[model samples]
Target: MKKIELGELLGQMTVSEKVGQLLQLAPMFYKGTITEGEITGPMAEMGITTEVSENAGSVLGSTTASEMIAIQEAYLKTNRLGIPLIFMADVVHGYKTIFPIPLAIGATWDVELAEKMAAISAKEATAAGLQVTFSPMVDLVRDPRWGRVMESTGEDPHLNSAMAASFVRGYQGNPDELAENHEKMAACVKHFAAYGAAEAGREYNTVDMSMRELYQNYLPAYTAALEAGSKLVMTAFNVVDGVPATGNEWLMRDVLRDELGFDGVLISDWGAVKEIINHGTAANSVEAADVALRAGVDIEMMTTCYLENLERLIADGALPVGLLDEAVMRILELKRDVGLFEDPYRGLKGDVDRQQDILSVEHREVAREIAADAMVLLKNDGDLLPLGATGRKMALVGPLATTQDVLGAWSWLGDMKDAVSIEDGMKAQFDQVDVAGAMDTENVTEAEIAEMVRVAQDADVIVLALGESANRSGEANSIATIRLPETQYPMIDAIRALGKPVVTVLFNGRPLDLHGLIEASDALVEAWFPGTEAGNAVADILSGRVNPNGKLPMSFPYTTGQIPVYYNHLRTGRPADAADAQEHYVSQYIDIPNQPLFDFGFGLSYTTFAYSNLELSSDTITKMDTLTISVTVKNTGTIAGKEIVALYVQDIVGKVSRPCKELKRFTKIDLAPGEAVVVTFNLTEEDLRYYKPNLDFTSDPGDFNVFIGTHLQAAFCLA
Candidate 1:
């Protein structure tokens, strides 16, 4: 049927039926029966006779395959309208065979590998009776204290856009295959607007950036996801400007729907619509329903506010019937797209071992390759990396060295039993290494510290694996200070004091304050939650099988006071000129340096690379033309390695101020010993465009500086 025809059919329905389409309740599952008591009982008690199926407009969590099938079957058998329920799960990384978090995957910069990971996740989730995943959270975050940064792609908008498109394509695949047997599930892009720019890096707080900053810094990923055919968009819990995002019509209607042409169902984050009452924006459930419905939020996730008062609002003339039909039609269109209207039992099978063939050996091999690629080498002074297997008595010490903390965060269904720790990975190579936990097995003690120090004295080199736990840096896990916990500091000090060479393998979800550790360790490797095969991948890099080419996705701060520091910040007029200045009126702190512990796009390898003079295609160009910037990168050291040639752009003069540097493009290339290659980046008007005060995007014709460098400061921009 045509979508407008479906809208007309929905428009003729009663108020209760239209509200029922917007209410997505949680299903109550039992041993053998899935009844409507939890949802339908409330409906009947509230005098709301018109309702969908028992499982329609609901989310199911943590159910076995058989149980899911039984519940779905009962829903189909008992419902009057026979609308198939949309089964959604938090398939953040992997469904069952878990991978690393999205930030770690972004470090790989391999779009093909990321897409393969999402495809495998979809296969596993589909086998377990899931029809949708709340995944590919594309919010661009620069602050490390925000706990949800672990779930995003990274700070760069372009890279986040690329990864977002790749993930959607992987999850949805071809529409033809999805038309057959519900071939693919829907990918939901989340936190609809600017949840990442929360004040002080707190989660679910107020976001108060200008509209220009919002459009330029945060909206690219959402736009890319829409273009990639994502069928659902989830609203954030934070308040933008002074209004809660769940109730902001300007964001949902003007920005997302009218501007971006997103016609998909707009779903709210868990209980966010109701929580707006606490945000001081809504007076009651009725008011909340009125606000959200008018703002274009079609689906109420886990919140019965819409079902409770949506009918009353429509009757009281606060909401129009046409708005309700618009929402219902969008929901029904998704149902039709998933083939649910055609075959109600399409994804309701309990026995899906046949579909388990999707998780093949090729998938596991790809996971290993991506995990190896995500590992960033932060510091490798004097060639301490690629440790030879012969005559190396290595001492591996730290609490996380042998633990399963490398799974990272939001690995909802990752098998902890199968995860390999750092000690296990290092043991496969050397036989003489002594493994000692830095802290107490149950609780940290002095004796454990003494043992770690004693073991460090005997070995030729010490390998310290230090990082945060998988649970310390995800949702509801925000930290006020991004420093190392006091418990791990003693072990680090003791190991560094042993006077032997120390290599620190840092495993973390967000960027950490590592000034002391950076100065103490001879070499540093950032293995940010390499998944189940983390150990094997680390062993491969440390043993010279795979070269370390991963670069920092987020800046590592020297102190927690510099919480939101990033490389693309603008230069103020009164910026500090002297590094030794004791006072400044600009954005400078009194005690701490403004520089980061490690800059973004900064990573080291076993070999050295040198960047020579940069050359451009022409000094001037017309408005319709493009420019090519070229630079030569040579491997100056003995061993072969790979380097990421980064290109940034700076607008010297504009109607409004601009960032000091913006990442335009980058390419990762492999080089043999003493080999050199010239890489080029083509830039058009799109790369130079900026949103004006009137919200128009245009590039002013002026002299722009193009920078080609390994790091941000070590670059010469051509005028």
Candidate 2:
């Protein structure tokens, strides 16, 4: 049936029947074990014609296919209306074959590989009885201190938008695939509004920003996801302009539904609808339901706010009956689109052959390939990498050298036993390698430091793996000081004193203050939690099988005081000049430099690449014209390597102040000895536009500067 025709049918249903569409309850069973009564009893009593089981609504931690199928079978057989439930899970990164975190994937700057990774994740999730994935979190997070930043694409809007579109396409492919096994699951582009720019980088904190900043800096990724055919959007936990996001009609209805033309179902984040009472925006559960339903939130996840109060709110004249009918129609249309109306068990099947595809060997290989590309080479002074295995005696030491902390953070449903440690990879490479455990499981000691020094005395090279534990940097894991633990610093200083060419491998979720380590080590690799295959991928780069082409997606700060530093920040009107700057007055600090430890797009290669003069197709253009900016890149060093040529643009005389440089385009190219290539980036008027005070997106014709290089200061131009 047509969607509008389905809306008319839902409008004829009673008020109690309309409230059933909003309720999503958890199931109480495992396999054939019946822990609680049938799902139909309570649902029938409340006049709920459409009810969702726990296994159908959202999967907690991890669940088996057999258990999920049993629950769905029971729901279908007992429910009066037989409205099939939609299954959802947090399949971020990977489902069973774990890959690197999202931030690490952004560092690779390879959209093709990221798209393939999501496709593999979708296949595995569908095999595990899931119809939806709450993934491709495209929020642009500038604060590394935020625990959820590890789940985002990175700090740039343009990069996030491109990656988001690729993920949506990969998850929901062409029409033929959608017909094959109900094709693919729905892709949920999450945190509907500004949830990343929280106060002090704290999770679920209040957000305060002008509308201009919201549209230009943060809203682009969500908009891109909608255009890519996303079926659902999850609301954030924070408030915008003193109104909670779960209850904000302007964001959910006016902006998303009216302005952007997004017709997807809006779901609350976890229990955000019930959380509005804690935000002091609602008096009780009934008021929370009244606010959320009016704001156009169609699904209430895990919270009983909607199930218990929506009917009362409608009867009391707080919520109109037409709104409830509209929400039920959208929900029913999604059910039919997924083919659940034809076959109730479309997503869940107990067939052993289908369950075997969840974590196949082919999926694991793709996980390893993506983890290797995500590794960013932070510093390599004197080209100290590509360790030779013929005659070198290497010493691998540190707390996390052989531990499971390499799995990174937000490894939901990921098995730690399958992860590879750095020590395992290094030992596999060479025959004469010595492994030494220098610290206790929980803390480091002085005796451990002495043992590390003694072990490195006879070795030709030292590989030190150091970073936080898995629990130290995730949610509720914020710290006042973002530095290496005091205990580990002694071990690092002791190993550096041995003078045996030290190479530091860092495993972290966010950027750390690495000033002391940079000065002590000959080389550094920022391997941000390369998931299941972390050890093997790091070994490949260390043994010269693959070159490190990954760049920093987030800035590495020199100190903790530069907590919120980024590359595209606006310049002040009276920027301090070094000649007249003093510690007492200007934006200068008394003790530290006002620069990052490593800038964005900063990474070293085994070989070097140089940029030549830039040429533009034309010097002047109108709003409808296009410009082609080209630059020549040549390999200057002996070793063959890959280089990421970046293009940045600046609007010099805008009505509002802009950033010093914004990344417009970038390309990664592989080069051989003495090889060169001409990289071209096309510019459109849309790339030059920014949101004004009134949310107008247009660029005024003026002199614009184009920058092309490996770093930000490579070349300059006027167009």
Q: Which residue pairs collide, candidate 1?
A: none
lDDT value for candidate 2? 0.77
lDDT of each: 0.79, 0.77
Please, what are the lDDT tens digits per residue for candidate 1 over residues 476-528?
A: 87899887666777778888888899988888889998877888899899988
Q: How well does candidate 1 match the true structure, expressed as C-alpha RMSD?
A: 3.3
The estimated TM-scores of all candidates read 0.92, 0.93
- Residues 208-280, model 2: lDDT tens digits: 8888888988888899888988887889999988899999999889988998898877888888999999999
What lDDT is obtained when candidate 1 is compared to the true structure?
0.79
Question: Where does model 1 exceed 4 Å of error?
Answer: 1-14, 29-55, 62-64, 174-177, 181-183, 345-352, 355-360, 438-443, 578-587, 711-719
